[model samples]
Target chain A: MTLSITDVTKRYKIRVTRAQVNALNGVTIDLPAKKTLGIVGESGCGKSTLARMIVGLEQPSSGTVTWNGEPIFDKARNMLSSKHSNIQLVFQDPYSSLNPRQKIGDSIAEVLTVHHLVEKDAVQARIAELLTEVGISPELAHRYPHQLSGGQRQRVSIARALASQPDLLVLDEPVSALDVSVRAEVMNLLIDLRERLGLTYIFISHDLSMIRHISDQIAVMYLGKIVESGPWDSVLENPQHPYTKALIAAMPDHTEVGNNAYEAPLKGEVPDPASMPTGCAFHLRCPIAVPSCSTNAQTLREIEPNHQIACQEVK
Target chain B: MSKPLIEISNLTVSTTDDNRTLVNDVSFSIAPGEAVGVVGESGSGKTLTALSLLGLLPRGVHATSGSITYGGKDLLTADRETLRSIRGNEIAMIYQDPMTALNPVMKLGAQLIEVIQSHGGDTSNAMERVLTAFSEVGIPDPKRAYESYPHEFSGGMRQRVMIAMALILSPQLLIADEPTTALDVTIQQQILALVMQERRKRNMSMLWITHDLGVVANLVDRVIVMYAGRIVEVGSVKEVFTNPQHPYTAGLLASLPKASDKNRTRLLSIPGIPPKPWTVGESCAFSPRCSKADQQCRSSLPVLATNTHTDAACFHLMGDNS
Candidate 1:
C-alpha cells in the first residue's frame, strides 16, 4: 500500500482580486509501506498544503496524488470515499480538532460506524480498545475533550485517527504543541503504534530535532518547492542545499553555549509566496549565492546516491 | 564582587478563591549584566514569577508574600507611583505574542514615542530615539516602519519592533516572557541574537521565561528549573546540563528528541502529567513521575541542597544545606 505523489501543484485564486498564490509547486514524493517520510519548512512553506492534498481535503490544481497507482482525485469518484479507511490526517491543534461537546468514546465510535469498519455491537469495545492503545485510560473515554489535558486530548485525536484503520497517517505537527516530557510520550507511542500496526507516516513539522529523530527520509521545502530530499543521515549530516544548512546551523545546540559564539548562516524573512524571487526562492537569503542564481531557476537534481539538492552552486 | 541588581526572596503567589499557593517559596537573584532563564512546563508558575517582578499579574492572582528588591528597594511593597516610574524607565518587558502586545490602531512610531513620553523623558528627541532603536534592532528602513501600523509588520518584524520599544528608554533590566516561542527557527535565532547583542551593548540584566530547554541552554548564563510552582534545580547552564541532580530535570533533558539520536527510536519520557497546584501534597511534587522516588520522597518535601556547582531539591541527592 504505497502512496505516491507525482508533480502535484496547488494554487489558490484570491477572491475579489485577480491574483493567484501558488501554495505547492511541482512536488513529487513516494511513501513506501511502514516508513516515515518527514516534511519540514517554515510556516508558509506549503507543508500543510501538501498534507491537505494527500488527505483529500484539498485537490491539486494539476498533477496527481495516487494510492497504489490509482488517482485519488478523479472527479468521477467521490473524494476520500474509495480511500477513506486507508489514509487519515492527524491535525496540529488537538484543542480545536475534537468536537467540544462530544465524548471521546462517541467520537471514535462515530468514525468506526461511519466507515462501517466494525459491527454495531462491537463498536463500544473497539472504542475502549483504541483509547487504551494510545496510552489513555479506558475510563476517560467517557470524558469530554475539554476535561482532558493537552497531552491526553492529543492522544484522543490520535485514537480518532486510528479508528479508521488507516495504513498511512499524515500527522501534521502531532507533538509540537505538547510539553517536552509529554512530547516524548507521544513520540514513543507513535513509534510503538507504527511497529504494531505497520503504519506509514508523512510527519510534517517545523521542528528539526523531532524531524531528525523520527524520519527515515526527509524533504526540506522552501517557497512551495522542495529544495532538498534524501536519507535522514545524509541530509542532516552532509546537507547539500544552503537552506538545509542554514536550518541545521540555526538549531540550538546545548554544547555550543558559552563555548563559542552563535552563528546564523542566513537571515531575513522568507519571501512572499505570491511574489517569490526569481531563480531560487532562497537565493535572497543564501549566503553563497552567485551571480547566475538570480535568473537561473534550479530543480532537484541527484548529487549522490539517493541524495538530492536544488542549488546550482553545489558542484 | 559588585552588589546584586535584583533580589527576590521567598516569593509566593496565591489565588483569591481558596488562597491556594500557585508560586511557593520561590527565590532567586540576578546580577547586573547577567541573563537568567526560568524554564518550566505550563502551570509551573514561571510566567507568574516574571509578571510579579512588574506587578502585572492577571486577575484573580495576587502576591501574598515575597520581597522583590530592585536596587536595594522593595518593589512588592512600593506604592503604585513608584512602580509606574520604574516600569518603562529602569525596567522593561516584552511578551510572547507581539501582535497583541502592541496597539492595533496606533502607528508604530506613535506607540514607541508614547512609551518614551509616558516615562517623562524629553519628548522632543522621542522620534529620533525611536528610529535609532528600530535601526539598532535590525529593522530595515526604520523611517518607513515607523509610519506603518502593527498589522503591517510580519511576526518576526513585530517582535523586533517590541524589542525596539523595550530598549528605547535604556532600561537597566529587561524581562522577556517567552519572546521567541511564536517565531520560526531561523527567525528565533535572529531575535535571540539581537537580544543578546543588545544586552551586552547596554550592559543590562535580563530575566527570560521559556519552556524550551534547548533555547535556555544556548542563551542564558544561568538556569532555574521550576515544577509545581517550586524551584527544582538552579545552577549555571554547564553545571545543570552536564550533571542534573533532580530527577525531573533529568527527565526533561532525556525526553527531548535530540538531533544526535537519529538511530534511536524510543524516547525516554517521564510518565504522567505534572501535579496541579491544588492537588499538591506534603510530599515531593514529582514523586509520582520519578523512578528513583522512595518512601521518604513520597512523605516529605526537600529543601534545595547546594553543592559546588548546582542546587537541587531532592532528598536522595548528595549535598548539604544551601
Candidate 2:
C-alpha cells in the first residue's frame, strides 16, 4: 500500500476581493507503507492545504491523490469516499479541535460508531484500549476537554484519531501548541504508537528540529512549491536548495550557539501567494540567484539518487 | 562591574482577588550591555516578572513586594509621571505578536512617529528618523513600507517595525517577551540578528523572556531558569548550559530534541505537570515533578545556594557535585 500525490494544485478564492490565491502548485510525492514523510515550510507555504487535500477535507483544483491506487475523493458525489476513513488528520490546536461539551470517551466512541469499526457492545472497551494506547488514563474518559491539561487533551485527540483505526495519520504541527516539557512526551508517544501499530505518518511542521527527529523522508516547501525532497539525512546534512540551507542554518541549535560565526542566511519573508515573484518563487530572497533567475521557471529535478531540488543555480 | 543597569530584588506578584502568588521572591540583576534570558514553561511567571519592571501587570495582578531599581530609582514606587517619562525613553518593550502591539488602522510610519512624539522627541524630523530606523532593521523598501498599514506587512516585517519603534529612542534597556516565538525560524533569525545588532550599537541591556532553550543558548550571555513563580537556577550561559544544577533545569535541557544527537532516542521528559500557583506550598514547587525530589525537598523550601557553576535552589544538584 502506497500513497501518491501527483501534480496537485489548490487555489482559494477571496470572497470580498474576488481574487485567487494559488496555494499549492504542482506538488508530487510518493510515500511507501509505514514510512514517515515530513513536510516542512513557513506560514503561507501551502503545507496545510496539501494536508487537507490528502485527508479529503478539501479537493485539489487539479491532479490526483490516491491511497492504494484508489482516489480518496469521489468527484460525482462531491465528498470523500469510504476509503478516506483510513486517513485521519490531527490538527495543531488541541484546544479548539475537541468539542468543548463532549466527554473524552464519547468523542472517541463517536468515531468508532460512525465507522462501525466495532460492535455497539464493544465500544466502551475499545475506547479504553484507545486511551491506554496513547498513554492516557482510561478513567479520564468522563472528563470534559477543558478539564484536561493541554498535553492530555492532545492525547485524547490522538485517541479519537486512533478510534477510526487509521493507517496514515496526517499530524499538522501536533506538538507546536504544546509546552516544551510536554512536547517531548507527546512526541515519544507518537513514535511509540507508530512503531507498535505499523502506521505511516505525514508529519507537517515549521520546526526543522522536530522534523529531523521524526522523519524518514523530508520535503522542504516554499511559496506553493516543494523546493527540495530527499532522504532525511541527505536533505538535512547536505542540502542543495538555498531555501533548505537557509532553514537549516537559521535553526537555533545549542551545539552551534558557542560558535560566533553564525549568520542569518535568508534575507526576506515569503511573498504573497497571489502575487508570486516571476521565475523561481524564492529568487527574490535567494542569495545565489543570477539575473536569469528572474525569467526562468524552476521545477523539481533529480540532483542525485533519491534527492531532488528546484533551483536553476545549482549545477 | 560598572553599576548594574537594573536590579530586581525580592519581587512577589499576586492576584488582587484571591491573593494567589504568581511570582515569588524573584531576584536578579542585569549589567549594562548584558543580555539575560529568562526561560520557563507556561505559568512559570516569566512574563509577570518582566512586566513588573515596567508596572504593566494586568488589571487583576499586582506586585505586592518588590524593588525594581534602575539607576538608583525604584520603578515600583515611582509616580505615574516618573514612570511615563522612563517607560519609552529609558526602557522599551516588544511583545510576541506585533499585530496586537501595533495599531492596525494607522500607517506604519505615522505610528512610529507617534512613539517618537510621545517621548518628547523632535516631531519635525520624525519621518526621516522612522525611515532610518526601518532601514536599520533591514526592511527592504522603507519608502513603500512607511506608507503601508500594519496589515500590509508580513509577520517578519511587522516584527521589524515593532523593533524599530522600540529602539527609536536608543533606550538604555529593552525587555522582549517572546518577540520571535510567533515567527518562523528563517524570520526569527532575522529578528534576532536585527535586535542583537541594535543592542551592540547602543550598548543596551536586555531581558529576553522565552521558553526556547536554543534561543537562550544562541543569544543571551546569562540565563535565569524559573519554575512555578520562583527562580530555580541562575548563571552565565556557559556555566548553566554546560553544567545545569537544578533538576528542573536539567530536565528542561534534556527534553529538547537536539540536531547534534546522532541517536534519535526518547526524550527525558519531566514526569508530571506543573503545580497551580495556589497549590504551591512552602516546599519547592517543582518537587512534585522532579525526579530527584526527597523528603526535605517536599517538606521545606530551598533557597538559592552557590553551586560549583550556578546558584540553584535544589536539595539534589546535578553535574560536578552529583
Candidate 3:
C-alpha cells in the first residue's frame, strides 16, 4: 500500500530539434498508505509531470517508482497491468475527461467491468450505489455528461476513479476547475471517501489555502526539484526555504490587503524550464540567495526527523 | 457621502428567444471611487450585469427594462456611438482569460497602438504611451514585450498586458470580470494588488466580479451576492462577510477553505447546484437548496428587505417584512 518514488527523472525530447527537456530532475518522495501528500508549485514546476509518472501514465527516464518495494514500470515484467488498477488519477478538467456521448452509469460500470471489480449482473446496482455515495442521484445515472453540472460531472469522474477501489488517488487540481461553493462540496466528498475507504492521496495544486487545508505532508517543488518537504503545518507556518516564505506571504488574505505599503517579495516570472540555471532554479527569484546558490544544486537534507529542505542557506 | 457614480435600477436582461430573463430586477449603486464586488457561481448573471453597464449585451440578448444611470446619462438608452466612445476610454473592461482577450497574430505594440488610436487624438507618441503602460504594469523590458505576440507572454504576463491596455487611457470606471481566475494563486494576488494600487492612484470606480469570497474580502469595499438572475444580498465587505444575512450568501462564505479551516475534516457546502434561469418559477430561486426554506419561500419570492447594515432577499430574516 506504500508508493515510493526514488530519484525519478523525466526527459522529453523535442520532436524537431531533438533537445531533451528535463521535466523532472532527480525527484524523490515517499507517499505512505492512508496519508495525504500535497505537491504544490506554480506552472512548469514539474508537479504534474511527477503525478503522471506516479499513475503510470508516463514512464520515468531514470529511477524507480515502487509500490510496496516492487518497481511498477518495469517493461519486461509488465508490472503496469497488475499495479495500475491500484492507482488512479482524477484530472483537472471534468468537462473534457468524460466522454460526452456516454451515460454516467455506463462510464462508471465500464471501469468495473474492464477490471472485473464487480459481477456482471450486479454492475447496474453497483453503479447506482457509487453514484449515491458521491452525493449524486441514482436516477441521473442515465443522463449524459452534459446534463450534469460541473460539480456533478466531477463527482461522476471521482466515482469512476473509485470504481476499481484505488489505494492511492492522484488528484491533479481536482477541485480547481469547480466553482467556489462546489469546490468545498467536492473537497468534503473526497475527505469523506478517503476516511470511509482508507485511501492515500497525492493532491496537486497551486492554491496555498487548499494545500494547507488537505495535506498531511507537503512537498514544495521548483523546477522539478522539491525545495522543501515536511509535515504540512511545520512547512507552511515555519517554512525553511525562502521561496516557500515568499509564496505564503503572497497569498491574498484579509489582513494582507489593508497594508497597501507591503512590498511584493519575488522578482520576475519563473525561468524557462528548458534553459534552467546550473544551480538552484529558484536562485534567480529567491530574495535571500547567496553566492554559492548559483553554482551548486542543493540536495534534500534532513534538519528534523521528518522535515527536509534542499536549500543550502537552511541549516 | 459623495454622489453615487453609477445607479442601476430594475435592470432586467433577457435572451431574445422567448424573452427568458437572465438578469431579473437587479438594483444597486456604486459610489464614486468605491470598489464593489459582485459574487456568485456560474449562470448567476454577474457577468451579464457587468456587461450591461457599458451596453455590451451580446446579440439575441438585450435589457428589457431598467436604467443604468452613469454621469447623468442612461447607459441602456445611450446611442451606439456613445457606447463605443465611452468604452475603453472612460470605462474599460478586463475579461477573465487574457489569451482570448488579446490577438494571437498581432504584435503587442501594434494591438496597443490600435486601441489608443481608436479613441483618437494623436498617434505621434503612441509607441511611447504603449511602453509607458507596459512599464506601469511592471512588465520588464517593454521593448521586447512590444515586439512579441500574445502567445509569447505567459498567463500572468498576458494578464498584465491586458491590465495595461485597459488602464492606458485612465478610465473613470473599470469592470474587471474575473480577471484573476485563470492565473495561479500567487500570480492572482499580484494582479489583485496591481488593480487595487491603480484604482487608488486614479480614484477609479471598480466593479470586481468574482466567485471567491476570500478574494472579495481582500479587494473590495462592498459585496453584492447574486443568485439565479437576482440580487440576494448587498452590504459592506466587513458587514456581509462577518455577518451574512442571506442563506445563499452565508452558504457561500461557509463553503470556502480559509486559513482558519486548517486540519478540519469537512467543509460546510450547500447541498445542490444552482438552478437554471429557465427552470425557475415564481418562488425564490434558492429555495430548492436552502435549508430554512418554508412554504412561503417556495411559493413567493422575497424582495430585498433591509437588515442590519445589509439588505437581503430572504423570507427567514429575523424581521417580518411580509
Candidate 4:
C-alpha cells in the first residue's frame, strides 16, 4: 500500500463566540500505489480535513497516517513540517495560489529555488521545462497570474506543483473553478502527468462524475469517515452506502434537466458537523435509513471481494 | 410557447473603453416559459448578453445598435424608469455569488420583503410572501432564517435566500448568471432542483448563463454557444449534445469530464486558447483552436445562419452558405 489511514478522527474547536462545531468524527482508509483515489462529499463534510491530515497540513486528533510503510506525521513530532518534501498539496484556487505581482516564471522557479533542487543558473530552464510540461507556452513566462486566463493560470499552478517532483500529490478541487472546455484540459493534464511521472494522488473533489472518470480506487467520504471503498466500477454500479448512491443519483448528465435525473432525491441539508447526529452520521439523508441506523454506528466491513462498506445492513 | 417572451435582434452592446464592442450583433429569442443556455469561455460575453437584456450594464457601457424586445416592448430604447420597472420585476437575476449580492447587515426577511414591496405591488402580504418564497425554494426553517443575518446562513442557504428574493416577484423571466458556479456540486444540484421546481410551477422563461456544458446539457431546453461577443451555435439541447453543429460547441461538450469515461486517458481538448475580444477576432474567433479552419476562415468572420431548426455561425458547417 502507498498510504494507509488508520482509525482517524478529527475535531476542530470552532468556537464562534457562541458554540463549537465538530468538523470530523472518526475515519479510516487505505490507498494503494500508482493509483488515483477520489473522496466525494458535501462541503464541510470533513473531506478537505481528511485531505489536510494526509498531507500533514492538519494532525489527526487520534489516528495514524502512514506513507510508503512509514508513519509520516511522527505523531511524536506533532505533524509539523520540519522540511519533509515527500508530499505536496495543490490547492483549489489557482487565482489565489499564484502571486499577482510575481511573474509566472518566477512563481514556478520559486518552488525549485526553495527546495534547493537546481543551481541558480538552471532555474530559468527548469521554469520553462515545467511550463512546457503543463502545456503552457514559453512566452507566458513573463506574464503575471492575473494576465493568464483561468485555465492557463491553473496550468501554471500545476507547473509549480510539479517543480519539486514530489512522490505523492494531493489535489484539492483543482479544476472545479474552470469552464467545461478548460476543465477537461486540466483533468487530462493531471492524468497525463501522473502516468509520465509514475505519481500517486489523493484527488479530493465533490464532482463525482469527474472523480469516477479518473480514480482507480474510490473512497466515499461522509461526516469525516470513509463510508465505502472499492474499485471505481463496483462502488459506482452497486453502491452499498446510501450516501454514495445519493451522490451518484444527484449527478446531472451532460445532456438532461434536474427534476428527472433523480428518483429518490437527497432530503434535508447536511447537518452541521459540530453537533453530529447520533449513530450513522449519514442516516438523516439515507434513502434506506432504518430504525437501527440512528441507534448503532457501523464500521467498515468487507462485504464483497474487494469492496468495503460501513453499514451493517448492507452486508 | 406561442410568442417569444424575449428577443435580441442584431444587438451590439459596446463599452466606452476605446469603443470596444462587448456583444456584437447577437440575436436570439426566448419563447414563453422556455429555457435557453448561453455558453463560452471566460471572455465569451455570455454575462454581458444577460446584463444587456436587463439594462444592468456596468457604468459607462452603452449599446451601439440592435433591438432588445421583451414582452413586445423595446427594452433597448426603453426609458430609465421603464428599464427600472423591467428589472427585478419582469427579469429577475440571480448572480453566481449570493454573499456579495445580499446585504450582510440586513435580515433575510427584510431583504426579501424589500424586493416584494418594490415590484410585488403591495406591502401587506410582503412578509407572508417572503416566508412562502423561502419555504418554496427549500429553505428548511423559513421563520427562523428570515430573522437571521446573511452571515448566519451557510453558502447554499444564502444562495437559496438570494433565489427566494429574486423569485418572490414572480418575474416573467429569470436570468441566472452562473448562480451555482461558486456552489459545490451537491448544493448546486439542490439549487438547480429548486430553480427547476419553481420554473415548472411558474412556467417562467429562463436565461441560464454558464460555462459548464455538462450543466446546460441537463438544465436547458436549448443552447446558445457564444464566443468573443458573438454566438457561434444555437440549437435544442438534444441536438447540441447528440450532434453539435458548431465545432466549438462540439469541442466544449467533448471536453466535459464524464462519470462514465472509464480507462481514463488524455481528455480531448481544443488546442490553443480562445481569442481576445479586441482586434475584431479576425476570421472565426475559434480559428486559433479549430482544426478545420482554412484560408477563408482566417480572413473573414462567419455569419450566423439557420438551417432547419438549428443555427450555426460557420463558413464550413454542413457546407452551408448564408
Query: Which is better, 2 or 4, measured by TM-score?
Result: 2
Indicate the worst ten consecutive residues by lDDT in candidate 4 chain B: B313-322
Off by over 4 Å in 1: A75-84, B318-322
Q: Can you tell me the DockQ of model 2?
A: 0.66
Colliding pairs, model 2: none
Across B1-322, the per-residue lDDT of candidate 2 in tens digits comes to 7789999999999999999999999999999999999999899999999999888899999999979999789999998888888888999999999987899999999999999998899889889999999999999899998999998888888999999999998889999999999999988998888888888889899999999988878788899999999999999887788789998888888888888786777888887788876677889999989878889999999999997899999999996733
Q: Candidate 3 vs candidate 4: which has greater DockQ?
A: 3
lDDT of 1 by residue, A228-311 (tens): 999999999999899999999888766455552555567799987878788888889999999799999889999999899999
Off-target runs (Cα >4 Å) in candidate 3 are A75-84, A254-263, B262-265, B318-322
Query: Quick one: RMSD of model 1?
Result: 2.1
Task: Please list the C-alpha lDDT of all candidates, in the order they appear.
Answer: 0.88, 0.90, 0.86, 0.81
Global fold similarity of model 3 (TM-score)? 0.95
Looking at candidate 1 chain A, the ten consecutive residues that score lowest on lDDT are A75-84
- Report the candidate with higher lDDT, 2 versus 4: 2
Q: Which residue pairs show backbone clashes in model 3?
A: none
lDDT of candidate model 3 versus the reference: 0.86
- In model 2, the runs with Cα more than 4 Å from the true position are A16-18, A75-84, A260-262
Q: Each model's TM-score?
A: 0.97, 0.97, 0.95, 0.93
